[model samples]
Target: MSRIGKKPVELPSGVEATVSGQTIEVKGPKGTRSFKATDDVTFSVENNAITVTPRGKSKRARQQWGMSRSMVENLVTGVTTGFKKELEINGVGYRATMQGDKVLKLALGYSHDVNFEVPEGVTVTAPKQTEIIVEGIDQQLVGQVAANIREWRAPEPYKGKGIKYKGEYIFRKEGKKK
Candidate 1:
């Protein structure tokens, strides 16, 4: 009954997948990733395509059907094309720079600079003072790192000054009447 679950995930050339028990592992040019699904769903790989099927008609089974399918797709995509998150810095003094190979130095109007450590398995780069690029084979990790950076100085409404995701819109508000 799940539309998304019904569609099989097609594996691109040079990408491989293996389903064992409740765990599915996908390997590709970029890297390898694995996901373990609940017992409510089953995974099957055939003809370079992965299909997820619910074991019963229960609500939990149906829910796992779509969730498992999407997880498999993400693993495949993560290993192949990887993932990227872009962040933009606002405000006059707000900017970011790579301190060295593993640290990011951010100036966001704080009395002192904010030092953000880059975690393993992900790459953080600052192409420009106003731009930050987060890239990795794991989609979730890439997004989490970007979010952590944005948390330092979330965009405000008045001047829209702060760190924000690229293309994000800030709803502005007028100042209080005198």
Candidate 2:
């Protein structure tokens, strides 16, 4: 028995979960999310809780069982409480701002400014000139957007001039002496 798979997901208030065939849909005040289970994975909701079970003993089946369960649980939680990712800009003259219509324009000490268009269902906010916050109900989409933004200018090991997670740690490397 899988420890994580055995644990039941508790349904929060104002959240409704439904299971149909291999698909599970969760609706909440924030939004609605759905996940499709694999062939060997099954899920059911009982007493405001959700459970996952595997249909076969194969390795793939076991893997899918756990993955599907976790995905469904994340979907439920995301819709209820949502998810957030924070990014910070480093280096002199490096900053970020939200442009019109889900577009984020960034200045990372480059020759030209970079423009990143945010995906639907994801909200991007800039509290300060260098701090960025991304929120959404979909975990996958949230993460992908964060990654894409981070990719614009990953922190360098020498000066660390770029974009990075708010609290992420980056090991500094020694610069070569001229």
Candidate 3:
């Protein structure tokens, strides 16, 4: 038996969930999100909890069972507390700021400033010149936006200068001897 699949996802106060056919929708104070499960797995809402069960004793069914449960849990969490990702910029003259309501301007030692257009359902803000915060109801979108920003200037091993996630560690390398 799958340990994660066997556990039911509990709905906290102020959160609501509804099931329709192969789809499940969750509504909370923050927002509403929905997910569609595959035929290999079945989902149900009962007693303020959501449960995922496999349709048959097959490998695919078992795999979908656990994954479906996790998706439902994420939906509940997304609509309730939401998700956030923080990025730290390190380098000389490296900075970030908001160009407009939906654009982020970054200066990472490049010839010209780079403008990143923020997509819908996600918000990017720079509280400090070297710090960036990405917030949204969808966890995947928030993480993807953070990764895209970091890709522009990943931390280097020599000086560890560039953009990185807050609390992320960069292994340092020694320079060549003169």
TM-score of 3: 0.98
Computed on alpha carbons, the lDDT of every model, listed in order, comes to 0.95, 0.89, 0.95
- The stretch of ten residues in a row with the least summed lDDT in candidate 2 is 1-10
Q: Which window of 10 residues has the lowest lDDT sum in candidate 1?
A: 93-102
Q: TM-score of every model? A: 0.98, 0.96, 0.98
lDDT of 1 by residue, 1-178 (tens): 9999999999999999988899999999998899999999999899989999999999999999999899899998899899999999999978999988799999999999999999998999999999999999998999999999999999999999999999999999999998
Native-referenced Cα lDDT, model 1: 0.95
* Model 3 residue pairs with clashes: none
Off by over 4 Å in 1: none
Predicted candidate 2 versus true structure: per-residue lDDT over 5-55, tens digit per residue: 778888988999988998899999998999888789788899999999999
Report how far off residue 176 is in candidate 1 (Å): 2.3
Q: If both were scored by lDDT, which would come out higher, candidate 1 or candidate 2?
A: 1
TM-score: the better of candidates 2 and 3: 3
Give per-residue CA lDDT, model 3, range 42-158, as digits (tens).
Answer: 888899999999999999999999999998999998998999999999999999999887999999999999999999999999999999999998989999999999999999999
